[model samples]
Target: MSPVRQWHDGLQRYGLVVALVALILLLSILSPAFLTVSNLVNVLRQVAVNAILAMGMTVVIIKGGIDLSVGSLLALCGAIAAGLASAGFPVPLSMAIGLVLAVMAGGAQGLLIAYAGLPPFIVTLAGLTVFRGLTLVYTNGSPITGLPDTFLVLGAGELLGIPAPIWVMAMFFASTHFLLRWTALGRALYAIGGNEEAARLSGVPVMRVKVFAYAFSGLASGLAALVLTGRLNSAQPTAGSGFELDAIAATVVGGASLAGGRGNAWGTVLGALIIGILNNGMNLLNVSSFYQLIVKGLVILGALLFDQLVVRRK
Candidate 1:
């Protein structure tokens, strides 16, 4: 590679890490409480759901696709389990049903896009609307409560002296990293994202790989739903609103190209931490929610601008 090209590549690879460290330093200085062990644990707990979703979003984006329905899907899937549990069904069985539905919902949308030639944005957008409606209708516009501790353990319970959600996120991050780094399916995803037509002509199973990508995204939503529902000890029909944006922001900020064919598990984790730290700091400093939203949007826009103006040239 040319000198400039190598420099840009290195920047793209390590920029997020640098940004995360800088953010942490800034936060720790701005708020003495930011470095406290309790505050750090709080940040970890909050990062779990978004990080898990981002991991799956990374896969779909790396495969040259986007999923706008994940937030709504989380509500629908979590409600399924929550509703069942409220009706006295076994915890595992209810969770299984919810997870299965999430996978099917995600895969069906993927199939429509891959086989029927529908645009992914349109299909998932429709899913976003449809799933939200289904969630509302299923729960009769109310939240499901009366959850058992057995079911809630996945969200609020600790394992090995660490929060369950943290462990869940760690396992997900590792598995996703391994898949993208080592598996043939991972190669197919990247190839398709880099150039779909060329990849198909090169004998890549483009459609199947795409479907798997979407389904995996669904599974992430499923897992996130369980944690979220557990944390709340109830499933809200309105839960996960705007979560899709958070996931995309993390994926984009983590060095993934909006144009596809780039991103890594570590980058996403760092991105999530940067975001978590920023939010935590903001809350500590008494920043308004309105400003926080603006800041978040600008952060995402900055990532896109950096990718387009600096990295894409190479």
Candidate 2:
């Protein structure tokens, strides 16, 4: 590649990092509390749920698919965990059931999309409603509380001088990073996103990979629910409403192309941080909640526009 092209490519890859730094600097200037250690840690804690969700989103989007149900799936999974916990199940066992339920839901979505050849958008859209409805029905439109102390610790506790949620986010990111950078499945995901027919012709197990991708997405959502439930010490039937948009926004803002085949775990982390920072800064500045929604919408649109530009340049 020419030097100019190389520089452009580098920009495309690291642009989100630049944006993140710039955002931090701006926030630090605008809000006196933005740079404090406590506040910064707060940012990471706040972003943890979205970051975890984005990790799975990175995989799904890379395979040219989307999962609109993740937010609702989170509510459903979280409710199950809290209910199980309240029913005297061990914390670990309850959590395991929650994760298993999420994985099963994801795998079912994958089966439909892969074997039944349903459009991911349609299938997952249906899932969004179904999961949310299930959550409400399960919880009777109420929040589940009185969770075990051990379960609350998962959300409210710290580890080795860091918040537990941050630790979980880091571990999940590291695992996903390795999966995408070093695994054959990861390469197949990219290939399928780049061109499904070509990937299939080259002996890629497209259906299997798609199934795995959706399943992974589900797993991520379930994990996120655990953290959220822990943090809140309760699981609201309406929890995670609109969370899928934030996850999708984070993935795209981190430089993942909506068209697929272009993104990474690190980028999603940065994207999530950017979002977390934006929300934090706005709250500090007393920006209206309505305006915050507007800002988030704009960010998503801007990321989509940037993705289009990158595609054109290529």
Candidate 3:
């Protein structure tokens, strides 16, 4: 490869690492607590949900699609799980039902897009509204609480002195990394997103890949719901409001293309951590919520600007 190509590849692969190091340095300068193990673990716990969602989002984006319904899907799943558990259902059974519902919701959206020829944006947008309404209807806008400790343990319990959510995130990431890097299915997803017409011509099974992406998005949301409900010990109809944005922001900041076909699980994970640290730092330093909003917007803008610069240079 040419020198410039090598540099570009390196940036694409390790940009998240560089961004993370810079963020830690910046936050440590702002507060010594930022470097403490406890604070760092806290940030990881906070970002765990977003990171999980973003990894799912990465698959869809890699296949040149988007899933706007994930936030609502998460809320719906959490509500379902909480309601079932409260009614004395076995915790495992409740979780199973939640997973099934999530898969069905996502599969419906994928069917609309792939078979009915609906646009992904439109289908998932409809999903966003429908799932939100379903959540409210299911819970009657009331939060469900007092979940079984078994379910809660998955979300709030610890293993080896580390938070359970962190361990879940780590295992999921490792599996996803292997799936994307070593599987034929993973390569097909990239090919489809990189160029659908070409991928089809090359016999990449575009429809199957697209469907899998959406279904996986649902699965991720369901898993996220498990942790979220456990952490709060309640399930609110609006629990995941705006979570979709966080997942999207993390993917983009980690250099995933809004245009698709160029991102990774590890990069998305780092992006979530960067965002978590930034939010934690702002809260710690007593920054006004208004300023925090402005800062976040500016940071997203910076990432987009960096994307544009990289593309132009290429």
lDDT of 1 by residue, 27-88 (tens): 88888999999999989999999999999999999999999999999999999999898899
Q: How many steric clashes does model 1 contain?
A: 0
Instruction: Give the Cα lDDT of each candidate.
Output: 0.92, 0.94, 0.88
Q: Clashing residue pairs in candidate 2, if any? A: none
Residues 120-211 of candidate 3 have per-residue lDDT tens digits of: 99999999999999999999989998788898986899999999999988987887788789999999888888889999999888887788
The ten-residue window of minimal lDDT in model 3 covers 254-263
- Work out how many backbone clashes candidate 3 has: 0
- The digit string of per-residue lDDT tens for model 2 on 85-184 reads 9999999999999999999999899999999999999999999999999999999999999988999876799988899999999999999999999999
Question: Using lDDT as the measure, which candidate wins?
Answer: 2
Ranking by TM-score: 2, 1, 3
Q: Count clashing residue pairs per candidate.
A: 0, 0, 0
Please name the candidate that would achieve the greatest TM-score relative to the true structure.
2
Model 3: CA > 4 A from native? 1-9
After the best TM-score superposition of candidate 1, give how far the Cα of residue 134 lies from its true spot, in angstroms.
0.4
